[model samples]
Target: MNSDLLILDYEPAHQPAFRALNHEWIAHYFTIEPIDNEMLDDPEGYILAPGGHIFMASHGGAIVGTCALIKEHKGVYELAKMAVSPRAQGLGIGWALGQAVVAKARQLGAHRVELLSNARLRPALALYAKLGFRHVPVPPTPYQRTNVKMVLDL
Candidate 1:
């Protein structure tokens, strides 16, 4: 990771950057679904208000990556909306953000953390695996693009 890269908590000022980063990645691989719009449009309502958290990675004073842990009932969090700017892809921003979110979930007393992803996103899946997430049976999901599910026990 870059020595200057910092993972910070989300604030209202980060709304546009958060949405743009996520939209850029999702649209590149799959169609943006209604659920994506709902979450991206009002992260505070759908995520933070429910006791979840969002983390942003800043490098050279620019937002370069983001990740979120959405509370899903007691002691469970869904790792979602992770993205790294194309320019920052090789700087380990994604790993830093992922570690931050997982650490946050554990700090919040989460028993498990799960994520929904696509098989085609091999790099992401590898990252998740490296973070201690293991493949699990895919549950029905709102996003048409999701075909892989993984979980990490805390």
Candidate 2:
């Protein structure tokens, strides 16, 4: 990661960057589902307003990646929408975003963090494991693309 890389909370101005970054990666691998459209279209409504948090990674003042922790239940959260710009993949931006989310989840008083991912995304799966997430049975989710689920206790 660059020394200049910064991870920060979501702002209204960051809405477009957040949607574009996630859409780029999702479109590259799978079609965006309606649920995806709904959430991406109004993150502050669906995410932040509902007791969740979103974070963005910026480099040289450009948004390069983003991730969010969506509250699933009291003290439980789902880590989702993690994406780095195609040009920034493999540069540890995703990992940095993940770490930031985990820390934020704890700060939010969460007891656990969970995520659903596709088996085809080996790199992401590895990153989750490296971040101390362990394999778990898939939970009900709107995304048909999910084939693997993981969880980490805070």
Candidate 3:
């Protein structure tokens, strides 16, 4: 990890940064889905209130990346909404965030962590792979952009 980077749990004040960072990357590659709008509109209600968690990455006091762990069932979580600011792409911010989120999942007692992603996001896929995620059959998904599914057993 970088000396200046911090990965922290989601806070109320981070709402806007959470929404903006994710929306920027999603829109850059594909249009947002209704499910995305639902959570982005009410993260605390949709995620935190439901026993899930979000993680934010900051560098030198500025929020630069975000990721979420959405509880889908007992002992299982969906890793979602990971995004890094365009300017910070090559700095390993995403990798740091991913590693932090997975560690959080283990601490939370989650037995498995899975994710739905688009196959076209090669860099993100590679990052997940390096973090111990492996390919699985693509399940039915709300987002038209999603074509790849991966999971990591905690």
Candidate RMSDs in order: 0.6, 1.0, 0.8
**Which residue segments of model 2 deviate by more than 4 Å?**
none
lDDT of 3 at 4: 87
Candidate closest to the true structure, highest TM-score: 1
Q: Rank the candidates by lDDT, best first.
A: 1, 3, 2
- Which 10-residue span in candidate 1 carries the lowest summed lDDT? 88-97
Q: Which pairs of residues collide in model 3?
A: none
Residue 80 alpha-carbon offset, candidate 2, angstroms: 0.5
**Candidate 3 local accuracy as lDDT?**
0.92
Question: Which digits, one per residue and each the tens of the lDDT, describe model 3 over residues 50-144?
Answer: 99899999998899999999999999999999999998888889999898889889999999999999889999999999999999999888788
For each candidate, give its TM-score against the true structure: 0.98, 0.96, 0.97
Ranked by TM-score from best down, the candidates are 1, 3, 2
What is the C-alpha lDDT profile of model 1 across 56-94, one tens digit per residue? 999999998899999999999999999999998988888
TM-score, candidate 2, is 0.96
User: In model 3, where is the ten-residue run with the lowest total lDDT?
Assistant: 138-147
